[model samples]
Target chain A: MEFILENILNLIGFIVGLTIGILSYIGFKNTGSPTLFRLGIAFLSISVGFFVVWAGYMAEDFVLQKGHIEKWVQTLGIGIQTIGYFFIAFSHSIKSFFPKSRYLRSVGMLPLFLVSAVHIEHILRSVSFILLAYGAIETILSYFEGKKKGTIFVALGLSFLAFGEFLGWYSFVFPESILYYVSISIKIAGLISLFIPISKIPLTKIKFDSEF
Target chain B: MSKINAEARMVTTYRPHMKIIGDILSTTRDDLHSDGGASVTYLIRKANVSHTRISKILSNLVSQGLLEQVNSEGTFRYKISSNGREFLVAYQTFSRFAENFGLVI
Candidate 1:
């Protein structure tokens, strides 16, 4: 049951990410905008990351028949997803990853020091969380500045992803619980929210006025 | 009074590079009444850009095959090429997409 649910969630994520990536790539090809190019790469990386984990699960079930996925496979998928998150955050041109407040900055670094011997998977997860959180904050700031309805959706989507990543990290601490499934579901919801604004693009409504 | 002031402020604000290109192409394609094409002066006025900037942009566009320079009579004029029309369509589409993301392209 767990494997089935996991596969379904990852498959949804993969499909959504792939669609967004293709749209961004098309936008990039049409306009030659560097932002669209970066966004294209970001979504593609995220889609591939989801595919990697789903493939790993399938391989374990069929080829290995191990009844459990390899730790390395999960780690590799998370690492790739982290790269995607980094690009998303980078696209926002975040001046600093850490919070401006000194107290918040200290709290942020506390996680790194708390781990006695940090595993690669843990480090990658932590980095992914930070990047998503930072990207969410930036998107929210943009919303406040621009007050665009579309930006609000983007901000909400990023926030959901960040919260999902935070919960995912907690899932590792309590592996026996249902947090892992919840996190995956939340991330999928975030992807859907992101799709809403993208689907609403008024392509036909755009007019080139001469008064400019 | 305030609405008029806001409109005035909007007019003075600089247009984005892509917007200027779109304006130039639009003026050449739609605003021109004749097959003789748009003169540099006419384009400069319609695009609201300086002579030097429009010259550079026109040169770039012609080189990219987006615009065709025609020597109608004694003066050179520009006509939007088929490529330019395709580019303009794509630009219009992507502009809406980018606007949704609060990005200018």
Candidate 2:
């Protein structure tokens, strides 16, 4: 199980990187319009960032094996993860905060920075979990607001992520290595979140049209 | 209350090619215009529309007098009015513009 998990993360990281690459191409193809062009760049940024995390994680692991190299790798991992988070969050919607940009469609990178910091810093993990908890609750609320499908699934998924982060962080506090698996599980969600939808949209759309 | 409304909303995001819309609306109008009027069921069957969508379209047509409701005992009969004919013609013209521009419906 340990070997499998370790190897698969690397493979999935490549796949995720590929998906983002596809997204970038699609964005560019549609780039006659500014909106799509910006979106393409954002997706590319995120893909590049994820690749960094994949590389940083491996580097940090190697460093941990050496008595003298521990602190540097941890710092490097933290930096890469932080930058990756920035790109991920920036790729999502965040424009509502600015009045002018409210209509412009916001793409803020702030949460990426925040969560990346929280994850590596340990002290801020509680705060990160709290923010995610709030997000999970809001996702539930959105389900009640006329969203016809996937509302519950999304809510449950987000809850899982929140719990995973919270529990992993708790384990980190006590220096229990077992909880690292839980933390790894939380990150692995990108595999499900990123790839499953790309595969299932066709099936879901078919069922949707036939039944509804 | 209408399935068609739900379907319409579903497809609102689809952005179909103008040619497809023209094909669909032409077939629908052909089936509806034959007798100078159409029952909702006949239109639904011909247009491949569900009851809900028929009701939504009828409601709009009635509001604009493009369709008139012939109220009968226990059942309402829907008939295409002159206003509807005009709207159909206008929609056809719009389809032409869409095709020329390579735009989606």
Candidate 3:
């Protein structure tokens, strides 16, 4: 049951991410906006990341039959996702991930140093959480400035993704709990939320005054 | 806000380069004279841009084959080329898309 659920969530994530990536690419091609270009790469990276994890699950189910996924497979997937999150944050042009205050910066770095002796997967998950959280904050700041309805959805989506990654990191600590499934579900929800704003965009040709 | 205030706010808002290009192309295509062209003065008024800026933009558009310059009775005029129309369409679509993302272009 757990394996099937995991596969389903990852598949959904892959599909949603791929769709967003393609749409962003089309927008970039039309407008030559660097923001759209970055968004395209970001979603594509996220899609590929989900695909990697899903493939890993399939391989485990069919070829390995080990009843468990390899640590490296999950780590690789999360690492790729981290890259995507980085770009998402970068699209907003976040100058610094850490607060400017030296004390606050040290507090932020404390977690990574604390986990340095732990597994590589833990570190990667932490990094993913940090990136997604930063992106979410930036997006929310953008919403505050613009007050666009679409920005709200994006802000919510990024927040969900950040929270999901945070839970994913916790799932590593408690492997037997349901945190993993909840984390995956939230991430999928985040992707869908992000899609909402894009779907609302009209693809039809804009009517000009002269056309009337 | 009153309608006048709203219109004033809109006019004062910043427009990106792509948007200005779209406006120029649309004006040329739609506000043409009997000769199927618009003068620089007409474009300047409609596009709400400075004469010098519009001159540079028109030159660039002509060089890019998006606009055709014609000497109409000793007065220079510009017409939107086929490429310009296609570009305007694409620009309008993408502009709407970007606007949804809270982007200017």
Top candidate on lDDT is: 1
TM-score of each candidate?
Answer: 0.80, 0.43, 0.80
Question: Cα RMSDs of all predictions?
Answer: 5.5, 13.8, 5.2
Ranking by lDDT: 1, 3, 2
DockQ each? 0.29, 0.04, 0.33
Q: List candidate 2 stretches off by more than 4 Å.
A: A1-7, A10-14, A17-21, A28-50, A57-120, A123-159, A201-212, B1-105
Each prediction's number of clashing residue pairs: 0, 6, 0
Task: Give the range where candidate 3 chain B is weakest over 10 consecutive residues by summed lDDT.
Answer: B96-105
Q: After superposition, how far is residue A69 of candidate 3 from its true place, in Å?
A: 1.5
TM-score of model 3 vs. true structure: 0.80
lDDT of every model, 2 decimals: 0.82, 0.47, 0.80
Q: DockQ ranking from best to worst? A: 3, 1, 2
- How good is the docking of model 1, by CAPRI class? acceptable
Tens digits of per-residue lDDT for model 3, A1-212: 77877787678778877987877787777657777788888889888988999999999999999988987998898788778877887876667654799899889788778879999878877777777787777777767767778877877887888898899889978987989889878987887788888787766564333322
Off by over 4 Å in 3: A96-110, A144-147, A204-212, B1-16, B29-38, B41-54
Candidate 1 residues A1-212, lDDT tens each?
78987798678778877987887787777767787888888889988988999999999998999889988998898888888888888887766665799899899788788873868788887788888888878877766756778877877887888888899888889997889888878887887787788887755543333331
lDDT of 1: 0.82
10 residues in a row with least lDDT, candidate 2 chain B? B96-105
